[model samples]
Target: MAKTQEFKATERIEAPQGGPGRGAMGGGMVGQKAMEFVPSGKRLAARLRPDRGKAVLVVLLGVVSVALMSVGPRILGHATDIVFNGFIGKQIPPGTPESEWPQAVQGMDVVPGQGVDFDAVAHVLMIVLAIYVGASVLGWLQGFILNTVVQNTVRTLRQDVEDKINRLPLGYFDRSPRGELLSRVTNDIDNVSTTLQQTMSQLLTSVMTVFAVLAMMFWISPLLALVALVTVPMSLLVTAQIMKRSQGQFVAQWRRTGALNAHVEESFSGHALVKVFGRQEEVEAKFAEENDELAKVSFGAQFVSGLIMPSMMFIGNLNYVLVAVIGALRVANGQLSLGEVQAFIQYSRQFTQPLTQIASMVNLLQSGVASAERVFELLDADEEPVDATGAAAPGRRGEVAFEHVSFRYDEDRPLITDLSLVARPGQTVAIVGPTGSGKTTLVNLVMRFYDIDAGRITLDGVDITAMPRAALRSQVGMVLQDTWLFAGTIRDNIAYGRPGATEDEILAAARATFVDRFVHSLPDGYDSLIDEEGSNLSAGERQLITIARAFLTDPALLILDEATSSVDTRTELLLQHAMAALRTDRTSFVIAHRLSTIRDADLILVMEEGAIVEQGTHEELLAASGAYARLYQSQFTAAAVGEEV
Candidate 1:
């Protein structure tokens, strides 16, 4: 069996917390309801700005759509008036309507007990049909307008979300889990679109619909209308109470969902490592725990939100019975017409219909709000700005000097302190140290990846802090310890440094680095796809490709941080050749722990902790019998006596 490779213990990194202010929805249920759809004002602005022209149209259409829908009850009330007028002319009683029914319908073939006027009945029927047709057409128009509104609004929101992600700072990605971020950007945003796009429009229409129906009902009979209106607040109070209770559940649901997604992404991203470690069962248990918690929260949120519709209907139905009884008594005393009583019932139903819809929308509104807040948090994260004033492009000499530089990744933990070094033009400087020493930190200073908390760095006798970062970086080439290659053809990666380079220049760079020989050995040469991170190729091959890229750039300064540490002796020799070829006319800085690697360097600096402890030529350092001498005597003295060392 092969040995299992164990990684260094996983270290936890805490990202700063962010979101919006608390809303009026009541406590942690705000988080707990069903999601943490924390709405952010800035995120909303960003989302609206991209397709602002279309968003304006969508909001306008939504307004017009609601306005149109609000007219339905009014039209129905008009039909009721027409019915009332016919009943008045016929004088039909509730129980003795059969003989008089024909009288109401033009008095045709009057039976013994049918009291309705036949002609009157016909008139009411025609009026009802006309009202129905008019209402239907208006409803269809409202739907047409809102369909454009919803679809366009969603498209605009999604595009902005994607754009925000692309423009976000690299540091934002370092702390955030990829799956959680992905969930908010793609999955959560999709839910927000579905949840609120229609609800927002309907919330307006629901208010209007309820008012229009109430006004008509009051006109018919204020006493009965007042009775119906009482139940409305009751419905609202009930909905508000449920919404309050459900907030925490929703927040918990989103939190659990994010955790679940994080687990899935981690499991998938490290599938090979997991298989090698035989951690499948352990991973499965963790995933199941997260998923189970998510399901619970989801169910709790849904269960509470689901109560609103049915409760609303029950309250409205109870009010309906009360209105009917009271309306019949008013009619018996000749204070109400039969049509007026019928219209009252219709208005009552209309009032509750919108109430039910609005209740449903509140849940989704909170969810969208939660999601919006997270999106805005990312946009608001602080980013390093491009140096503006007193900043110029890097000059040709590339004389990099770190003067009394000190740095710490955190406020309390200093990694490099009061360290000073210089790299001259056309010279090769190598940094060596024990593991966890500040060897790599020196190279990082040259690139200005993290600015020194104290002291300053300069290039060509100019302060680097005063130089435009883009211009400074343009002249420097870097080969990182972690190799990251995009999923593109080999030629594309090589040409990434100089997009407009001629074929001859690319071939020259490849040949100089001995990359062309290996590339030509492949089936497709430079056109072959390497997939993500060059997984199809050997580690050394990927390093060679990156070396070709650096050569293509022809940067004035080059940095190789443990550049060939992973390769075998044979490949290391080829790398040495590649490095020697590239360093002939440019300044270079190499970071390695190996003692033999620094033998050809123009200058060597050995670090301990965050301080440079020794500096000199290889033979001088060996003669001094210090830290460098000890390191060399332990590892390289025997090799240098005879071989390629």
Candidate 2:
């Protein structure tokens, strides 16, 4: 095995901690940047501006709903005063003697229950009922319209994220975990969805309700309205304090959530390795640590935010008591009526109800903003460079050359420097090296997966950099040792190479790679379903399918990187035969561990530390007794020892 960097024995890796003022729900793990990078309020508004027409319609409907609903208490007050007047008017006339009033009330049409005006009462009640019903209908309509607007916005946001993923460079994926990205795409986006669906409309309605209720309260009696106003600053003070404390916890909460997701993803993907090493307890322990951290931060955030409702309710009740006492005094002084006092009390409740809702919504909106920030960060990431002006090399013979190429994954450490090679059409060049000796990096350079810092690589004597990436990759085919097969029928997997390959073409390729051997044995034949990652098939069978896939492509050049490593001896022999046939008229670059597989190649190159150390035909290299000879001998001895066992 090649010497490569490894984790030091003394190195300790710990779960990351969030920064100061950065709460749990915010993406704020150490070395993990906060997801909410954008601070501009205008930018967020701009994102919603595209759906402004729908938003405006929703607001209009909400206005109508709240306007109709706002007068409900006042109208009910009118009905109350009407009933009071119907009874009291007949019973006692103003300025009548109190002692004589009893006889006077009786003498008038004031017989106990019969004195009340059912006709006027019913008339006013019907009007109030109609207003409430209309308000209900408008409320439902506005909610429905707002839901459409919110859902479409979420749909468009998801599409943008999807498009951004495709545009991101490979380096970005290299630096980020699959789970972290998955969290942003799923959890973070869903948070935004929830906020849009539920919180947004409620927020608008709550604000409208507060203002309308305030106006109605003042119209009823300014004295009672002044008493209600005393609670506003106090309620706001409590809400502000709780929000300040809770914000950091929320940031920390989400950051821990992301970490937990990443850990689960890593553990599950490598479950086989975990079991083989009997590290189930260790995995569970680590999971528990993250889980516990998440619980702690989530509880802290919720506990702080939870205090708002009760605190605001206390203030509301205090206002209710003050309004009732003060309004009663006013009524006794003839400054207000019993009906007006009742209406003012209801208005007080209505006013505080929205404030309570708005406080709770502020917390939810904070979380949503945090999630949106993460999504926007992904959207803002730098994308892979593409030059549409570049030429399309569509029909070129396979002639590849590398000259003084230099590259590095990091600027501080070079992986390949001044590397040069040449491979002509119809020639097979084998690259042999120990692990991490830059074999794959070299192949990556040829495929333009990474651009070189210095020097140029050419295909058919034309600079590869001048060719469009899609056009260049179309002419090359690769079959890696770690064969990847999606969940599909065997026939579908084979046809994936060309996408539009006919039945005859797929069958022919399958036969050529001996994939037909196993397909015939399965109950479904060529239609056999391969489970996810081809987990249902034997390792050798998956390799055969991958080989068949490459055969179907029939590209100008073939790259086989340890392609036979996973197959058994008999399967390897069959694949070698198939590969030999495939390479008959094609330029092939083979990277392998087994020396026997590449013995008949037109040329063999021995690589060490990113440079070609030896190059010759098999017999000539064996005669030279250099790096190639030593590698061959070591493998020969290993095979002999294996046979004896």
Candidate 3:
């Protein structure tokens, strides 16, 4: 039977302190904060290090594109100068280029009687258009390269997560919530992907644009450029303040999202149980509470980050007005041309545009960093111990022994100590125990699901730990109390036991386990489809399929842990006969609550509190009249009283 461990509600719902969800929504102690922003951001960036070559290429493209776009305003300013000079110079005498004109036209290049240089202006406009087109083309190419890099990086991250899941010890799954783990794998990774896709290209372009446009601004008019630079500090102050306030909320939002997803998954998976217990209102109330918390944090994050762009724009407009006034005065004093002033004003707008963009991207960057930290935590978890090098392989004779083995799930609480047992070749050993008596745990040790802390377990006198886990487990087959079936045809599910089994072998195993009795009656025989949940099959039918699956492995040893507990009396009797045949010439460990099922076994072990209290044939154990005798008598009395009622 599967052993159930007791845990507090809080333990199931929350991660350990200082883990991924240590923020406000994670139910940490008061005053605890999420992970620091800079470290998490740096860790996220490290994931992209493998693609640094591509990243550098993307940066180059962005710089070149911004450079091309920045010169357009200067070219357009030249066209403006041509028109202004022509208007002022029309009143001068013909061919009077002798620098004797009025102050407005003194420094201007004007031709007498020339109303306006339409041809020159058109030529300049065309050059500006070509520059913009080149910039657009480079921008598109940069986006394409960046998309490839981001997608490849995220793909590698997903594969790493998948591999890590396999390496994690089974105990990790026992302590962690299924929904929370799923949220990390699916929701958090996806958030990271989206964040990278949306922000990477834009951020690169925005920062480059800031530098390129600022340089152009200084080239056009240093005084106006300085005036524009004044707003830089104010923009930085606003962004820093807002980002500081919103960073925690962004972390809290993702954590709350995970918690809510966990609750929803648990409720739905146990929907029938919740209805049986009449806890629908309580479940809904909890859902509402979590949903409300998620909404509040999400709102706070968006609202705070949303303040950045407007503040930047406000500061930018002030800079623009100040520049326009000063440049106009400079033009009037003949210190700068009207065209230069026009170009400087345009450069000022371009400069602030990128700052606003950077401000707007703060929310995405923060959220992405939060999710990336969660993923990193999963990757950094301690994995199961590595397999021994040059490992031995177990012999197929099926002789198993535990020599003074000691094991415990926790350091301070010992479960099994100084336990020793032997199962000889081809013998059926039945283990009878109450819940938490270490029956299943003993089987787990035999399979090396959890390693023993002291002493050695051997198969055919070869230490199991010395053998690779695959080699050791290949010799054994297990049938658990829970029956799991994926979405596939019945034949496919049966063949999963031994992937390359022939049709005849599948049929033989099915007949031996009595799965063939009902399989042939279905509409498609072995080809009938089963849903992911296997809801179409009865409980007994599901157990029969699992038994057939175990039979197909043709293993040297078999474990049946409450395998027939779900079947009815008639089906149980049939399975007992089938199992008796399957156990021939193979060592078998049968864990059962029903004494009648193991009466004919070669050996029976009565275990209590992780130690064997009695061992003998059923008749011999009954003759001793010990703990086994009391348990049998109590069960017999209860059955007799129930029949009388």
Candidate 4:
């Protein structure tokens, strides 16, 4: 059997301490301040290297389109001059007064009776129409190509993040909230995707239009161009100030969004618990607080970024007034033509528009980069170390031994120290311990979820450290207390571990685990659909499916970590029976809180504060009357009292 590559499913902790976008939305994260990180534009750009050729093509199309757009007003101005000269100037006498003559002929070339050239003017208009149409076509092409590139890039980015999540060490997940990691993949990557889709082509077009308009304005008249240039610095100054104030807010917005997602996820997942405890009002209040914070940050970001448009318009209008006054004076002085002044005014308006658009996109770009930074941070996380280069272990016979193992989740507070045990083939070793007594830690070490700090673990006399994780895990099967079922049919969920299992094998495993009883009664039989996390099914039902899943694999070694803790007495009895049959001929390690359930174990190890304090059969431990005996007596007495009541 090939081991599953996906990590074990577990809900993330609430309010994880740190990840990308830390201290992004407001002060700190999870009620504590976290260090902030803003990704560089150049860094985000580097991700596009693979699509450089297509990106360049899109930019080139944008430039051509803007060039065509720029020439339209100039050609139209020429046509206006032609029409004015052909008809209006025929009446201006050659000896007209110099001051009056300027007004009459300022926009006309006077060749007395160059009468209206209707054909020439119509021809120029037609060429201008053609240019506009061509530019529109180029614009559409650029947008289409860019969309393809952007979507493909985003798709690849999401895949990389998924692969990274699988490779990351379990310790990373232990410290971070699942919601926050989810935000990185879903929200953060989506932010980047939005920027690429909406802003990339627009940014390119705006930049090209600005430069193209400037060049056309200078060609029309340098004097008017100079007047228009005065507004450029003022516009830039306003944009820069607003951008500076809004940068942090944009970063904060995404952070708040992630926090809000985490809160909503946690509340919904624990909704039953909240209702049972009558904390609905409290949960709503918390949701409101997070929602309000997110709204405030988002509003600040948008409001500040929004100021660029009206501010640029004001600068544009002011520049227009100056150009009109000066161009008219120059026209009256016979130094500039009316047609040139009109074209220059159009160019100035065009210039201001692109500046405004670029200013507006600043928010999107910053938000995207912030989100990209978060995603990159996950991609750069420390992954689990590869297995040591040594000979692969022979197919495991489940002869497991831990040699002087010592470990801790945190270095300062050790959880397990110098623990040693041996489970012979076909031996069913049961572990019992009080809460936080390291019962689960023993199984975790054996599976190498977190490698031991010191000493070695072996399977069938072969060092496990040398075996690839996938290979080692393939030989072992785990059924945890929390049953995880993905969105699929019941049959598929059961056949997850052994994907190639036939219908016969699946039905046999289900029968052995007693899942067939329920499947046979359901409307869809084995084909019933399981919703996300299997919320549609009862707790016992989900556990039964997981048990059948483990059974289908027929693993050489089995680990059951409190697999029946959440069920009722009847379900527990049924599960225990199924477990007894499944454990036959296989080395098994079982951790349980109900001591009675494990009374038939070949061996029982009682743990306390990370060390084994007792080891023996149930009768043997009772005769010794030590910690195990006391624990059993207390449980037995409680059961007797409940029965009497």
lDDT per residue (tens digit) for residues 160-220 in model 3: 9999999987656655566778888999999999999999999999999999998898887
TM-scores, one per candidate? 0.81, 0.89, 0.93, 0.90
Question: Which structure is stronger by lDDT: 3 or 4?
Answer: 3
How many residue pairs clash in all the candidates, one count each?
A: 56, 17, 0, 3
- Best candidate, TM-score-wise? 3
Can you tell me which runs of candidate 1 are displaced by over 4 Å? Answer: 1-170, 633-645
Instruction: State each model's CA lDDT, in order.
Output: 0.70, 0.80, 0.85, 0.81
Higher-lDDT candidate of 1 and 4: 4
Model 1 accuracy (lDDT, Cα): 0.70
Q: Model 4 — which ten-residue stretch has the worst lDDT?
A: 4-13
Which pairs clash inside model 3?
A: none
What is model 3's C-alpha RMSD? 4.4
lDDT of 3 at 434: 85
The per-residue C-alpha lDDT of model 3 at residue 521 equals: 90
Q: Give candidate 2's root-mean-square deviation (CA, Å).
A: 5.9
The CA lDDT at 43 in model 3 is 82
Instruction: Give per-residue lDDT, candidate 3, residue 112.
Output: 78
The residue-by-residue lDDT of candidate 1 on 1-645, one tens digit each, is: 112222112111121232111111111111112213333533454554555665465455444444443444454544554545544434545455544353333322323333445565566566656656665565555556555656666677677667776555443554456667777777777776766566755775677677767777777789998999889779879988998777666655665566577668778978999999999999999888777778887888888878887898899789989998998887666576555677677778777888888887777766666556544454455556557686777798878888998987557778789888888898999888897687776776666665678999999998888887778888898887666677899888888888999899988888876678788788998898889868888887787778788889989999988877767788788778778878987899988777666689999988888888999898989899999988877776666666863
Candidate 4: the clashing residue pairs are: 24-252, 25-252, 28-33
Tell me the lDDT of model 4 at 195.
85
lDDT of 2 by residue, 521-618 (tens): 89989888887788889988998899899999998889998998888888788878888889877789999888999999998988887778889899
